[model samples]
Target: MDITEFEDLIDRLGEDLSLWPEDRRSSAEELLGHSADARALLESAHALRNALATPPVRAPAGLADRIVAAAKRRADPAEPHAEGETAGN
Candidate 1:
């Protein structure tokens, strides 16, 4: 498979080559053997998978509440603003 096809397969099938169909896995392995770019793309896909699997960092307490309050203030046209600010300013 070409590099473009390889990339599309990575997006569709994820970073795990073992889970790919036998035909596709063989073709992808062939491409990876000869193309440094393909190897690099596979490495990047693995890194992205590993990163996504990591536990997300916790947000600081009250951050979500502050965001919701800010959004509500912006959405409510009747809501009053501070002395120097307008609705969107």
Candidate 2:
């Protein structure tokens, strides 16, 4: 199979060659044996699949509360300043 066909198969069947239909999997393997570009494409597809499968990183605990508190302090005109400080000081 050609590179375009191989790419289309990757898109449809994902990076797992074992999950592909028999004929397509054989064709993809044949192409991979002879073509560096096809191997690279398959590797890249695997990397992308792995990246997508990874769980997202979460914010630290109390981060939302800290952000909200900062916003409220900025928004409230009457919020207390440090001791001995005046407005616009």
Candidate 3:
């Protein structure tokens, strides 16, 4: 397997090379053994996999209300004044 073939495998199977089809796995591993570029590709895939594996951060408390308030202010600037309050304050 060459760099292009290795990249195609990564794109198809993602960071987990074990998930690659059996026929392609050995050649992909061989490419990884012989090429620095292939190793870099694998490292990048690992980083991306790690990032995606992480849980999503929670929004700060009351953030949804704040966003809705902001959207409402944009949608109808006069509405807040009609209620004698600033939209986001």
Candidate 4:
């Protein structure tokens, strides 16, 4: 698989296992026949996908900080801040 395949799989990730076809699974199994690392990576991705569907017991508080940072970067600085005229204007 290439970047497009990975990107597509990521897009339809939630409950869309069809991205990984059964035939391809057999191929993967064959490819990883003796490679533990490959098998572990595949298992890890599967577990992560499964875990994504579960609701968090506690909401992440850092989201507000992240949103603020994103907004600051995206926000126009209140009419470009006139020279010597404070934002209070």
lDDT leader: 1
Tell me the TM-score of each prediction against the true structure.
Answer: 0.67, 0.84, 0.70, 0.37
Q: Any idea what lDDT model 4 has?
A: 0.57
Per TM-score, the best of the predicted structures is: 2
After superposing candidate 2 on the true structure, give the runs of residues whose Cα lies further than 4 Å from its correct spot. Answer: 81-89
2-60, model 1: which lDDT tens digit per residue? 99999999999987999999999999999999999999999999999899999999999
TM-score of 1: 0.67
Q: Mind giving the per-residue lDDT tens digits that candidate 4 earns over 1-89?
A: 43334444444553234556787545554655766765555566778878986987885889888677556644655445535645454
Report, for every candidate in turn, its global Cα lDDT versus the true structure: 0.92, 0.89, 0.84, 0.57
Error of 3 at 47 (Å): 0.4
Runs of candidate 4 exceeding 4 Å displacement: 1-19, 58-89
Model 2, 12-82: lDDT tens digits are 88999999999999999999999999999999998998999999999999999978866776677599755
Which residue pairs clash within candidate 1? none
The all-Cα superposition gives candidate 1 an RMSD in Å to the true structure of: 5.2
Stretches of candidate 1 exceeding 4 Å from the true structure: 60-89
Ranking by lDDT: 1, 2, 3, 4
Candidate order by TM-score, decreasing, is 2, 3, 1, 4
